[model samples]
Target chain A: MAIIEVNGISKSFGSTQAVRNVSFDVSRGRIFGLLGPNGAGKTTAIRIINHIIIPDSGSVTINGIEAGPLTQRMIGYMPEERGLYKKMKVGEQLIYLARLKGMDYEDAKKATKYWLDRFEAAGWYNKTVGELSKGMSQKVQFIATIAHDPDIYIFDEPFSGLDPINSEMLKEIVLELKDRDKTILFSTHRMEQVEQMCDDICLFNNGRAVLKGDLREIKRSFGKNTINLEFQGNAGFLDELENVRINNRSTNFAEIRVLNGESMQGILKTAMEHTEIYKFERIEPSLTEIFISTVGEDNINPKELG
Target chain B: MNLRQILLVAKREYLTKVRTKAFILATVLIPLGMIAFIGVGVAFAVWESDSEHRIGIVDETGRIFPRLQSVNEQRYVDVSAASPDSLRQMVVGEHIDGYVTLGEKNISSNANPEFVYGGSGGLGLQTSIRSDLREAIREERLQRAGVSEEVKNIYDSQIGLDTRKLTAEGEETEDDTGFLTIIGVVMGVIIFISLFGYGGLLTRSVIEEKTNRIIEVIASSVKPVELLLGKMAGVGALGITQLAIWILAFMGLSAAAAPVAGLLMQDQLADASRLSDQTDEAVSNFDPAVLEIPSIDPLLIVYFVIFFILGYLIYSSLFAAIGAAVDSETDTQQFMAPIMVPIMIAYFIMLRAMESPDGSIAVIGSLIPFFSPIVMITRIAISEVPFWQIGTSLVLMTATFAGTIWLSAKIYSVGILSYGKSAGFRELLKWIRER
Candidate 1:
């Protein structure tokens, strides 16, 4: 069952149309990614879903109820710009945020304590946010978002400020919530995280959703014409390839997309003449390639469409 | 829309602000600072009044010299016997405070007496000396004109005006109009300061939430109207708490001051008798009622609180809206200028109300919502304000603030989420119009 159904929401600020006919849905017990570049209306769409902004057109329903204060309580949103009261203590700030979401004081405190312990940051409960390191405060902000234990969680650019280890930990927690049958929605430009974690996604380019649906199905529809090549030598012959679009190329690796009527074997032979190939495999296009191709095709048209 | 959400926000705002060291310091220091300021002023007045000046008079007009000596025997010395150089040396050596040399031309139609001093005293000292000389010269001129002692005594008698105020109840009482005017201005000033001081605090808190980026998180959970209302309630309560402390402190100090004021009055009477050389008459004739402290009407305090809340609400909502429109404190100056004008006008009108409580300016000022909180309170303190004016002012203020809050909420809801660009008046208007 779809927990969140955003139907054709449109929003504008003055002459600038921020989101136009953007529509998507997230099913229960799933990780949904809103993949987009910067300034691509992802934040605006998320805000509409959270009921922080009233869309110029369309409606959002959460569990058969229209999005509003009632549905707002069902969601936990961590915005791209994370903030806590700099002078407020970690525990008090979290509890305050939880209480704002309709949690009782005792429950909020208990939840705060549980989350602090879960993050192994119990010692930082009394410390003010200003006194914490960037990574530490980011953890506190994450805790604040989840401490209320809402059924739906939304994170925007959640891993931007986290170190690799912390990012891994955050990913694990997000997946853990998914295992518990909680619906999660997050927006980011990073495709690898989306590819690894998302069961569904809506790719945004210029405030329009160009591609969306089940992540696996979307990837499968892109076909197996793309090849992942790993080699050791001069990769100079990649320049001589025709009818193939080279993407994400490094000194020892390349992802190649063969257009229609292009021979994958001919490209592999040319790569072999220039370097020794250690690995070669036919694969469906990555989210990165799909995003580039989709957005690239979108850029070809006039951008300011009504 | 949610009372619990508003209360939650209010609670956090109240606790966080009250916990800060700045709040504690401001609460305690302001009353202490005022007391210190008043104490210094009283001490200076007492010291200035008690001290007497010694003058060396070189009366080349021999007719006036003896008169000057007879008027105040201890203050004047006949330095006419000394040479000019010796007199200059005496003045330089501090033998005398300075000298007054009167020539024959000085006692004529327009006397230009040369009264030089070593600059040891303030303008008060100079004024006293000049008046004394004028009196002596007048007496000398009168004696020379063959006027009798009885007529001269009649000329010397000073007439005083005894003022009394008729109360609304039709009883005449000791006039305390001047005293009450001071009280009224003080009350107005307190309200003005609280409105500005606490209003700025509300604005700063809004800017903090917006700039620190916590506004989105909070706004998502609660409506912007709830957040603004909550902040105002929390910060307003804090202001009232601080004011309560100050009022209590004022009451305590005044209670302790009764005995101290009595002692000071006694000292003043003693000094007066010594200076006038009429010991029995000065002390016997001194009426304590002349210096009596009038009782304040408790109803005025009730009015004060009503006006204070009304004024605070009106200004704080505007302040909060300004905070939302700007990204930083530095950007607030542009918006602050417009809001500051009415507050300044109200303060100036309060001063005018002190002088003529029933003046047209006072009457109109008290009726306007922006000025009424200050101007009306001042008029109420100084004179009997009619029931209808008070009622009208209260009604207008309450109605005006309701409208202000509604308008502010519209602007606040959109302004909080907008980032990067500084807001202009056009932008603010658009936000207010955004649905």
Candidate 2:
């Protein structure tokens, strides 16, 4: 069953329409990746789901209840521009945030300690956030978001400030939550994390969802025409190839996407004559390719939308 | 809005703010600094006002020397034989406060010869010396003019105005209007300072939350109005706490001040007339209590608190709104100018209120919402205002602030999320008008 149903929700700031007819749902025990390029209304949709900004039309519901203070309490929301009181100690700040979500003081403290320990940040609990390193503070902010143990978690670009190791740790925690049957929604431009972790995905471009489905189903529908090629010689022949869109071209590497009615073997025959073909194979499209193709093909510049 | 959420927000605000170094310093420093200063000042005053000193006379001519030294032997300051150089040495050595030098007699000159002295607070010495010398010269001159002592007394009698004020109840108070103005102005200034001091704190706080993105996170969990009220109440409670500390400190100091005052003034206060510039012989004949500190009504203070809360609510909401509307503290200056005008006008009205507490201008000013917080307090201080007028002022100010809270919250909710560009007046009006 879907825990959150955001139906035909639209939002605008003044005359600028930020989100247009955006609709998506996240089933229970799943991590739904809110995929979008920059300024593509991902944050707006998340905010609407969390009820930070009232939508101009439609509605959002969590477990059949409309979005409001009660629904908000059921969701742990970490904004893109995350913040904590700089002068406040890590433990105190986390507990305060938890208490705001209706946790009792004792439970909040316990949850804060558990999360701090889980993140291996126990020694830094008494230190003020300003005294922490960037990655460490990011950990603290993440801990703050989930410390209350809400029914749903919404993170806007949770991995943006994290280092590779911290990002890996965050991905583990997100997936671990899904294993425990918690619904998770996170918005990001980084596609690799979503590809590894998301059970479902929605791609937003220019304030509208251009593609969305179950992760396996979306990939299955893309067919096997995409090629990841690694060669030992010149990539000059890639420019002359027909019915093939070269996504990236370098002397030793090329990522090629074949248009419909084009055969992969036709490109392999040409690549074989021009360069020593090291590796060429049909594969499913990556979340990155899907994002880029969908977003780029729409001729939608999110910068202009912003 | 849930009361628990509001209280939770308020609690955090109070705890965080009270922990700040600035808040602690301001709360402790202002009152302690004043009390310490006044305490040290009293001790210094006691030392400076110590008893009598002797003066030296340098008479180059032996003839004038005997006559100058011929004055009374017993006086606060007595003349002793010493030259100008010797007197300078004595003054430096603490042997004498100062010395006076008489020039060589002016032959054929009618004006008295110039004499110079180096000392402070020798006015009593100056008066007696001048009178004695002039009397001696006058006896010589009067003998020539055949003028009588009775004629001299007739010309010397100085008459001054004796003023009094009768209140509506036919009770009289000494017309020490200056004291009333001082008390009234002090009360008004205290309120004005706290109103802005704490109000500006709330504004800066809003800007801080917005800039840090803390407001956005919290805004999800609570209404903007609840957040604003929580901040205002929390900060207001802290302000009251600090004020209470000051009041207690002041009262404690006052209790200790009386005995210290007695010990310090032991030599001076015995002669009750020494409190005034009028001679003991002169004022001792009349009532000793010609000047008074003037009493203030206890209820006036209660009115001050009521008006203060109302004024603080209005200004702080504006400050908070400005904080939301702008990006930083630098942007607050232009917005603050409009807020400051009413306060400035109220201050001016306070000045005028002292002069005519019952005048049309003062009456109307006290009735207006903007000026009532400041001017009305002064009006209450200057006279016993009717209960109905105070009630009306209170109701009007309360209603005005209620409306201001609703309006400012609208601007605050919108401004908190906006950045980069500023919200102009048209934008602000739209925020107020927007659903």
Identify the leading candidate in terms of DockQ: 1
| Native contacts, share recovered per candidate | 0.84, 0.60
lDDT of 2 by residue, A1-306 (tens): 789999999887778788999898899888899987788899989988988778889999999999988998899888888787888889988888888888999999999999888888899889999899888988888888888888899989888777998889888888888888899999998776568788899998879998998988888888776998999877789889887777656779888988876878888998899999889988888776776667675575533321
lDDT of 1 by residue, A218-285 (tens): 88898897999999999888888888888768999999988876999998888888899999999999
Q: How would you encode candidate 2's per-residue C-alpha lDDT over B285-345 as one tens digit per residue?
A: 5432332234556776677778778888877888788888998888888789999999989
Judged by lDDT against the true structure, how good is candidate 2?
0.79
Q: Please write out the lDDT profile of model 1 over residues B1-435, one tens digit for every residue.
A: 889999998999999999899999998888788879999999999987777778899988788778888888888999988887888888798898889888877777675687777888778778878888899888877887898999899889999988998877989988888888888999999999988899999999999998789999998899999999999999999998998888887777776677677678779888887788767576777665544456778998898888889999999999999999999999999999998999999999898888999999999999999999999999999899999999999999999999999999998999899876569999988888889
Model 2 DockQ reads 0.59
Model 1, stretches more than 4 Å misplaced?
Answer: A297-306, B40-60, B64-136, B259-293
User: How well does model 1 score by local distance difference test?
Assistant: 0.89
Steric overlap count per candidate: 0, 0
Candidate achieving the largest TM-score: 1
Candidate models: Cα lDDT each: 0.89, 0.79
Q: Note the residue pairs that clash in candidate 2.
A: none
